[model samples]
Target chain A: MFDFDATMPLMAVQFLLLTAILNAVFYKPLTKALDERDAYIRNNQATAKESLAKAESLVKEYEAQIAAARKESQSIVEKAQAEAREITAQKTAEAQKQVQTQKEQAAQEIQQQKETALATLEQQVDSLSRQILEKILGPELVK
Target chain B: MEILGSLTILNTFTLAELEVGEHFLWKIGNYTVHGQVFIVSWIVIGVLLIASLAATRNIQTVPGEIQNFMEYALEFIRDLTKNQLGEKEYRPWVPFVGTLFLFIFVSNWGGALIPWKLIQLPSGELAAPTNDINTTVALALLTSLAYFYAGFKKKGLGYFKKYIEPTPILLPIAILEDFTKPLSLSFRLFGNILADELVVAVLVLLVPLFVPLPVMALGLFTSAIQALVFATLAGAYIHEALEGHGEE
Candidate 1:
């Protein structure tokens, strides 16, 4: 029917009431649930991203330290080898100089001993010839 | 003689002559209300309330069957508001638009589904609340008020300034459209629902068996379409009122 009367206002009021009630029970809760799930997903993704970045940085730092340590150890071993070689060469040179001085002293001692022995033998021979001449001339000169 | 014989057929043809303008009037405080509209509408509202409460009581991230369907339906309604009213301004008006769609949708399908013939009325038989012109008029008037409220609230008194813009010549025509908006909204719903009911009734009277099934199915489709049309138009009107220009 085309009648308006009280029905119009009443229907309006009823619809408004229905809207209010439905908003409370239906729209609000559903939106909340959906938004909650969305936020949870976004939060989890952020956490995962942060953790991955941290782990990557840690791995990089560890690799750099290992590289530095390997270089340091290699330099230490090379330095020790250089020191040992220098010491060995210096000791060999000192031992060769001492041997040369000892050989020269031994040669001088042998030359001096040979000269003393030759002089003693020559004095003995001269003394024996003079005694034999005196014994042969002694009797006639006295008569 | 032939008239009398045809009158017998007319009598037997309908369950009750389509009570086009009839209402079981209730007198309340110097005002008469349509009782049948309220009766069926209350039932529709009660069903909506119960189903809504049941589905949403134990709200979970993991949805159940009824809850899933209800969410899909509500999401569809939200999308309608968003597309019509634009994105930022749509959230506030969801309740208003959702109520119109659900109320009309439920009422129309209720009229089509409920066996109101079994429970007879004293004056006229029971039907959908939308079958009454008064109810549609009330809903259309609310829509007009809503758009006007949205415009006034959003744009302040500048809302009325659009009437004379581009020229003052179209002011009267623009004002005339305000009246026609409600008229068209009410009549479209009332006419379609009433026609569908009459057609289905006639078919059932003629064949009363398998013949009415397809028409009934079509009636369901029309019911849903009408509900969507009403809600979408309501949102569009509000959208227009809130916009800066009417030159388009």
Candidate 2:
């Protein structure tokens, strides 16, 4: 007969029970915690990668905007300068025409004074009036 | 013979030789525990512990020969655990499962190597711990317990629900399957180790020296296989626990 002790079977059962209890108390949580930690690490890694890509793309978008703004401002300044030059040229021509008209009026008055000094004031005045009148008309103005 | 005389002297000093079965006697308050093969087994376990500890105590990164061997064994078990249970949930159980494998492995091989004949007790010869039904059954029961607890804790009452799955037609069978899992796992290991050890003992007896070498080699193989089988079942059980006993 095999040397079977009564307690031996109990010991085997106890072994089963003991290990089961140990697993319940220790192994299960240990593994659970480990798995949880692993998942957390993976999730964080994915989030990090996504955010990193987002940041990189945002930087690229900002850079493009900055470049576009620079070009737009450059064109705007160039247009404003061209407009300023045109206005300056137009004002200069207007001022020169006004000076020419003033010179012509002064010259006509000086010619009338010279005729009065030469003792033909009345005739000169008459001629001047006629000239002025004719100058108001188209043929005298052309002459 | 000379071995018996030496054992007597060693037994006088070390508690490792305290026998509890058939030979020596100790009366403690009218209860006597007999000394038989248990002492030799305890001594075997102790020696195993000491040798393993020594091998790993100052483990170098580069590893000396013994350290390398121990590391290889540990890493081998680690990989097995990783592969079977997966990298996700196999970390903590590595030590427990790996220790079980190493303990059984060393015990099995120890029986083959250390001339068991060289050690003597008053009655029967000492066999490997695995050869004893108690040890194998104990290991099997523990593994079963581990998986059961893991399953319960992981999936809770839903784990039991898994047993009543497949449209309830296979409920009874599933329950039976759950019960048989531990029995099969335990018996498989016990049967293999016991048979291998018995065969080797018989062969050694039949032929004193030469013919037993091959059987000894076979014993080594059996030891490794049993260890792997035990670990594999443990990993499978853990996997089942993680997945739960769902319909699939």
Candidate 3:
């Protein structure tokens, strides 16, 4: 068992040959595949992160646009309400002025009719009084 | 004496006998090799190759089961190498360290799990490649050579300056460490694996029942730890060489 012989050198040669064969068939290609897989995963992760950032930014932009549109629409509604209020006030004032002018014209016509009737009644009363006096006294004696 | 004599007689009746320090030798052009080690080692290597091919056949960005397992293993080895050698120098040495870990881990586990005794051998039965001293020594020597090569390549002749660092009187000790490194590495693996196998074999011979189950499990655990220890030490040695004496 302790004997040292030519087997040692030949076994060494065989081991070297095995090493060479393993290097060619095993180590080189396997390492290459591992590296390629690593790179592939890393690449996918990077792109995924990039797209996520883009989506977040787009969400923020759309939200801002929506907020601005809401403010603009609110202001437009308020402006329309204010304009309607102003037009209603103007129309109401114009209608009140026309009603006041019609009332003044009707009062003037009633006053004119009353004055003409008073004047005619006074004339009729004078004629009746004169006739009554003539009938009561004798006409030849008084003359 | 009577009990001992009777125990010897009882041992022969067991299903399998304890085998130690035996080998199936095959003659090459001018050298003899352990045929059993080679046979199991080829099986281990074939398993590794098939698993690797299946994992890598349909490579995709989104990995399936086999691909995921292979990637996990690769990542583990990368982290181990990086921790030892630092970021700058770990890339080149990942394959070497990973190969050592995988080979030793598989060999040790295969030795424990496979029923090599069932297959009758002419001489010695098959075992883990690492159970043999030759194989561990070869692995340790390779680690030594790798570190030395790394040091030389990175620092050139300046690598030798580490022996005299702090004081020249420590030169002999530093040089002695080089010899001890490989010696300890090889012996640690060989002894642990061989001892585990022996314990299991002895238990199986004695009881031949469910009694050896826990020890077999323990053997498997130790086998994995031994593989880890060997790989970690080898990586540390390489890192030490690459770091040089400049920092110290």
The top-ranked prediction according to TM-score is: 3
Instruction: Note the chain A TM-score of all models in turn.
Output: 0.58, 0.62, 0.80
- Candidate with top DockQ is 3
Candidates' DockQ values? 0.52, 0.04, 0.71
- Each candidate's lDDT (Cα)? 0.86, 0.64, 0.89
Candidate with best lDDT: 3
For residues B36-68, what per-residue lDDT tens digits would candidate 2 score against the true structure?
334544565466455555555554434577655
The collision pairs in model 3 are: none
DockQ for model 2? 0.04
Q: What is the C-alpha lDDT profile of model 1 across B195-248, one tens digit per residue?
A: 898888767656767888899899999999999999999999999898847544
Interface RMSD, in order shown: 1.2, 7.8, 0.8
How many clashes in candidate 3?
0
**Candidate 1 DockQ category?**
medium
Q: Which is better, 1 or 3, measured by DockQ?
A: 3
What's the distance in Å from true for residue B26, model 2? 8.8
Query: What TM-score does the first chain of candidate 3 have?
Result: 0.80
